[model samples]
Target: MTYLVNDSADFVDESIEGFVAANADLVRRVHGGVVRATRTPPGQVAVVIGGGSGHYPAFAGLVGQGLAHGAAMGNIFASPSAQQIYSVARAAASDAGVLLSFGNYAGDVLNFGIAEERLKADGIPCRCFAVTDDVCSGPADKAGERRGIAGDLTVFRAAALAAAEGKSLDAVHDFASHANDRTRSFGVAFSGCTLPGASEPLFTVPESRMGVGMGIHGEQGIEEVDMPRADDLADMLVDRLLGERPNDNQRAASPRVGVMLNGLGSVKYEELFVLYRRVSQRLEQAGLTVVQPEVGELVTSFEMAGVSLTLFWLDDALEAAWTAPATTPAYRRGGVPLEGEPRDADDFAAIHEQAAPPSSEASRSDAAGVLAVIEAIQARIEAEADDLGKLDAISGDGDHGIGMTTGTRAALAAARRAVEKGCGAGTVLTRAGDAWANEAGGTSGALWGLGLRCVGTAIGDSDSVAAAAVVQGIRDATDAIMRLGGADIGDKTMLDAMQPFANALAEQVEAGTCLREAWRHAAKHSEQAAAATAALKPRKGRAKNHSEKSVGHADPGAVSFAMIVASTATTLESIHEDVT
Candidate 1:
């Protein structure tokens, strides 16, 4: 469906490239994403908002005066890597601090949270606020767990306005959180969206039917009903959002509200205006005074034939912030007085990589085995990529397979480069992990990347990797995943398979088994653990919203982890033969 793409994997990058070129006066390219062309006043809180790349205007388009200072763009429907977020934040942070805001998605939260910690360690004040505005993602009591949709515009604007007003980092963060609390959104889709180079849509709706409560990603709606006319659909969205209005707006005689009727990609502005006509009439009848309501595509999902409506209940402070002047390439308001000069060429800095550590001869020999294992993993992922995508499509955005392939390919290339540099197994793995995380850009990518880094840390470059070291590395990697991802054994994530594999490998190694035999034994347990996920409901990630849909299917992440371990076991067998 994406007719203009050269390669599916390069779509996001190419799009960002062209976007920066077109809006050179408004924005400039950065290592991870984009920043304002002009400099910000020193010591002012910088607002950096981002998520995946499919949503246009949302992240990159919102970067300008009185808006986001920068954005960290990710792969298609994937969250940006922690390194990407960190890079963007570092570029955007002023003397005061940096405030990171994004939609409430698993990968975004994990990656951004990690970036926040990294920034803090660098002595930069940083805080993260995840926008949870979709009313359909969860019940009112669990609103904090809801996914963010088009309502991101309201929250991002509020936070950016506070930052533009020279508020402290704490004040900017509070304003963002308050804006999130007061916002609610609901959406419906007539059809699903297709990723670049994909033959089919992510999900489909029957003719004359509409999917209710659709997500911005390729996630299917929670429910479906017969399609209705424009006015009827408007009523549905308005009534749903009004039912979940913030508590403070419930008793107001005439509450003023900010409205956003966002078209998800393909929906035309004419159609949106028709829908907003009824939406406005209904709000007026409900005794709510509408403020400057936005009626267009603020956030999109490629070419999804859907639309979402957001209601931002405005307090006096919120209204002032909402009405503030803003100048961006996509979204513009009243003209803003420019005080800052044009950005100089030297303002952009390159992201530098550390040199690989030295390795002993024995450790370098071990590095060859690591490279072989990574090659085997990549081959296995390439073979099973389609099936993995199908499994993920049951409950998720269905990009896991593509992400794995991208990450593994990057990992293999990085491992080869490290080996050529005479690095040890640990350094090779560490570089590979960094490459994977930097390229993949998703929840699975972040977890696997950090997990590999942890394993590499446990196995130092200076020494030969022994069975005991391997066991310790697995244990450390498992623990790191649990800590970073916040998922346990039964969460239906990669941890389900990885944790079992780690435990089994440790038991076998402690029982005096050789590394190759122990790994083979652990692989079986991982296979069984991955399959066992079919009986459990997902308690985390985007899949949680559609848990019932995935009841009979194994988790894609768990299955992929098991497959990787099994493939690595075969590589270990080959290594054993060579050593013997």
Candidate 2:
């Protein structure tokens, strides 16, 4: 089915805009995301959850006084950037720190990790708990490496409810982590979904087949098999989930559980009810009492033809939270006490109107040069986005190309404005990085923003530009990326290319090479490093789910970095030749 949208490129922003417009009573717009319209108590911990835009109730639809305090939405199938996460957290800040929660995908980890660091640096303590509940993604021994699907709801609800109960940050994190450990989910898809503007679905299943154990980001199932009858599907899901109850709960006698039969997208409500009927009968037969069973689309991929079942093993505390009142746009439970009377929020829109500081004439001229580099990078990103997305689709959610294209175009627009305004190198880069992070909203976007800002800080607006300065900037950016992303050189991230480039550039420049010549030499090392990633197993990001299948495919981040650097080096060399 074709989606009704005004502009394909404006889909995410417009969707968020419409969400805020319709849910004004429960949520309000913030700088980089949305927050609850009603304020929380002064000392209450804020639970903020987020990810890509395609998952509905998991993010914006759940922002309310008793559920998530805020949500940072990103482009479809991409993780929200660090800047977006931080802004949403800041809008929801209180005397108590923030508890940032999301699915345990690679992009979410990187972006949320950066936001947590920034929040702490700004005098607000923060903690992150990533949900890992997809049973088919990994074995119980390695659950931490699994991808999160519908289980994001159970974990987020537990944390948000604990926070609403005035629990400490530690308690919030504990409860969320506890919920993740206790929750298990399994899913099967009959067909894939198409993005808003896409002509076809991300992937397809045979007419007589079904995709088993799938992710929420339009990712195809791990294994395909013959389609089964509705009752057979229910039995299969219940048996598998019950077979591997959390280690601690497996020993409990008559363990009560909260059952959720979720529809991904295209699966109708009546269909879910039919499945739930069989599921409930099986649980009863197994001597497990179902507490507060739910059958609905709590989280979804865009029009995906699939369904998933989540079993949240309930204890005294978990059951209490499960029944706790929650009020949001798409979900509402018992009457939750409202924090405050709904109020007008006319003052929150000032976050986008920041002014860049003045800089020297030479620095402003250099900023114009940086703008050219950004344009070249944007062009390359646009040309290769589809290929990059295809690489990511092999194991990831398949939005890398879109994220990169959107982020680079945004960065170029910002840098051009800064250059015209007579800004310095640092100011130009800072503005561009912020724009990139906010627009792209993914793991690569957040890290790239951090790296750019680090480089900008090292190359001060007041300093003289030289080979030493550029080397220092590259080294600084590399370190910041490592610190923020928690990935070493072999983790198959953008850092794989970044580290080698910095090293080569530093060595060449120290030995009296000009900036352009040194840059060309460094770009060679970056390209080689990017290509070498094909042989390594991914330990981080979405690719980790299919660790073995990811072998022989160079990471998209590493590949993009090599292209940007190589292109920039060529532009610089041509400029040098003209000047001579």
Candidate 3:
């Protein structure tokens, strides 16, 4: 269990603040995350890598000379927001362009992909690459769908090294992609990790047993087995990786490989060294030359009793990058040559809120209604946060409850501020959406943010809100979510409820039902749809990695969506009753 924390909600922010203060010489705090203390040289590609917090040295710790130019930090076990990624990239990019790299998780893919689009729209060159290197997550034929684990170290190093060598953006991206293709990792956990202020760990393993194919984000392992001796575990890991050797390296003359025996938080360095001794022997017996094998913590979960072994099949270029000098807060190679001057104090950009658009008296009245509904949603989420988190833990990283609570709280605050400014319902929702995305920073956050924005745009600031307008807004939001999330109605996601709710509302509105009556009917459809998800297997997100475990459990996202819509229906009915 995490022992040192003051207000679990403020944990990530406080940790980042303290980390920057401790490593001020190498890293500087930016609006969204951290960047190298020194500026990037002109005409050199800037490599930015990131994901959720809690994976210590992987992100912030790797931002310095000969490594990542910056890192966009996110909430624990969540992806950084698109705005966060964009801010970090803008702060780090040079004339050559920027290369964004991260794990191939669903949240990371969506957020980083959006950031890449934004960079291009602003006339800044950018390319994003998702590292898929964990063999346990997918089959060899579908390697592109695998999750990235400790093997991310190899890909990040390749891109950063190429950038440091003054390579162009394309070249840096290619190097990173190549490294990702050659890298393969497998992990195991003896026990799960507990989040800050949580009463229990995310998952538990049987005594004298180990969970195999575990993820770094507090997800339960795919399989369970009796714990093995140190040497036996080493043999098992080495043999598994050897079976996954890149096709090109299968017959190479004196093939070289870079190894990283990464500890996933609480595992001691002494234990790793003991395991590495046997790993080294096995590699030598296989006639493979190991180059600069790293044996310690690199990418870690918060105090997870787990370890992962990454085998980076090295070619000439990869080997050179592997051996290149690097200097960062937590990692360093040989001596590194300093090139650029210290970063300018004025480089960190400040965010300012935009003025609210003018609104009519009738529109202001509608805004009040919007605020009331958001307040109800926030309360419902807070009341059900623990249950939602436990439900998600069956197959996911168990951060859904935290994400929903944070997003809704921020959205509610933004809505209230907008109401004070006399904004219309549409403008209020737009501001709320922005706040939700910026604070929550994950797949659900991005989806809810986008959906809210779409609905707001569809329902313009008119004198009165009509049932037809509400139905249209629901349809627009549902469409946008489906497009962005790449999930269909039966994917065991929030869409399972959202689609049915939208359809039911549209039908009732077309039948001339009152807005309150239509909404109440729609809420029932959503609730029923959410409940139906228990019989379906998840086909997206972290839960997809353990589809079997997800059976008989509704998606946390679907349940939360149902809860919000149901509560909003009550709020609408109460408002109508008070007006009458």
The regions of model 3 sitting more than 4 angstroms off are: 165-168, 249-251, 357-365, 390-399, 422-424, 460-476, 506-521, 545-553, 570-580
Model 1: residues >4 Å from true position, as ranges?
Answer: 249-253, 338-345, 358-362, 394-398, 466-469, 509-514, 572-580
Q: Put down candidate 1 lDDT per residue, 1-580, tens digits, no spaces.
A: 6788799867888999999999998898887799888777787888998998888887899999878899998887788998888888888787888999998888998888778877998999999999999988888999988899988888988998888878899999999999999999999888877888899886777898888987877555678899999999989988998898888634466799999999998899999999999999999999999999999999998888999999999988889878889998899999986646677777775654456677777778888988999999999999999999989988886778989999999999999999998888888888888789879988988887887787887776877777787788889878867876778988899999998899999999889888899999999999999999999999988788789999989999999999999999988843322221
Q: All predictions: root-mean-square deviation over Cα?
A: 2.9, 3.0, 3.5
Model 2, span 244-335: residue lDDT tens: 78776354577799999999989989999999999999999998989888899988888888999999998888888888888999888888
- Per-prediction TM-score to the true structure, in the order listed: 0.92, 0.92, 0.89
Worst 10 residues of 2 by lDDT: 571-580
Candidate 1 lDDT score relative to the true structure: 0.87
| Per-model CA lDDT versus the true structure | 0.87, 0.84, 0.87
The CA lDDT at 101 in model 3 is 95
Candidate 1 residue pairs in clash (backbone atoms < 3 Å): none
Tens digit of per-residue lDDT, candidate 3, span 442-551:
99898887777767766567555556666777888887677656789778999999999999999987887887988899899999999999999998887886899999
TM-score of 3: 0.89
User: Candidate 2 at residue 529, lDDT?
Assistant: 98
Better of 1 and 3 by TM-score: 1
